[model samples]
Target: MTIKSFSFSQLADMRIEGVGIHASYSIDIVIKDENSSSGKNVYISATGKSNAARAAGTGSLLFWCKVRDLLSNKIYSLERKKGEGFAVGFDDFVIGSIMFHIPYNSSSAPKIELEAGYLYDAGYAGTVIPFPRSLKRVIALTQFNRR
Candidate 1:
């Protein structure tokens, strides 16, 4: 089986009471078994940086997936909590990884897609001072262009 990989990066900036905050992050995805020709599978991974010390809190990471049910026209999802398979030390920059599984039945599987979201300094109180900062969330998808 051949492995394919992709990467993404995102940025979020918000202002509350004139306080500016920013966050930025990036992630990588690796497909360990793309040659199955049976179906499609996906994996999610990421890394981030914050201006505040210990901002990420043990470098926590969360992974989520959205799946659609063809028969019912409904969507389903799977998620993983922080500290599942990655680590975030005391450093200002933290890296993490999460894996997702999709089964392609060779005749009934659709392409796999992944999305990611992140919050920076969630618990910080908004003040009148402008902080000129940004927050970022990175998303990566594998098998995105494969049929």
Candidate 2:
């Protein structure tokens, strides 16, 4: 099996503050081939501060990261679960980070787009920071031998 990898770094810091919550962070996304499978794996890691003040109420605060297959227009949203590598700190008011992974089949086309940001209360209010236009990556996948 052959493996290919791609990495992306944010061009600018992403910041969103509202309803007593605020998040400021930088993101890094990596796409690589799975060692034992034909599919690819997406890894996202965001580092900085994601916090909700005591007055922000008891609603859940989530970090949102998504990837779009430009060829198929399929969007994959990263899940927020501890077992999936999603972990962020709130109310601490200190710099921190979060990460998650998504597995997907290789795209027919060579390019993909990514967007990252934060969401509060499952859509109450959120911000999306898209990858820079120039950063849309063109990836070359290794052709697999068919039995």
Candidate 3:
């Protein structure tokens, strides 16, 4: 499987409900492997940092890294702060983390897109950093794929 990413900006327009908003973006991905089987395990990982800070009352903005499977049309997502939560502050950036798993596959390279957003008071504001366009870098890993 090959992984790549780019930068995104569409997210800058989103807002939570009452909290502030700050986020970054990356590009999509496409995983292709001939060893794909019925129970092969596939794993994808992504990360980003805040480029700017949102307005006030925005609480601590939240960011997330997501992976989308074009073939299955299913998505596995991860957040920056799993349970610890976020605080409202500028220059206080938190790292987002996400881990996902797929049952298995046969012979298809599922298209993947890496998305991120900032959790604000208005709503989620972010975008799916397009591949070879917006993202700067991206990576993909198959934790364990048994035949």
lDDT winner: 3
State the C-alpha lDDT per candidate: 0.38, 0.40, 0.42
Q: Write the per-residue lDDT of candidate 1 for residues 37-122, one digit (tens) a residue.
A: 54434443444433322332322324333433332233444444443434454322334444444554334433444444433333
For model 3, how does the per-residue alpha-carbon lDDT over 38-58 read when each residue is reduced to its tens digit?
543454443344533343433
**Is candidate 1 or 2 superior in lDDT?**
2
Give all TM-scores, in the order shown.
0.44, 0.40, 0.44
lDDT of 2 at 51: 41
lDDT of 3 at 144: 31
lDDT score at residue 116, model 3, on the 0-100 scale: 53
| Residue pairs in collision within model 2 | none
Judging by lDDT, tell me the better candidate of 2 and 3. 3
Per-residue error (Å), model 2, residue 82: 12
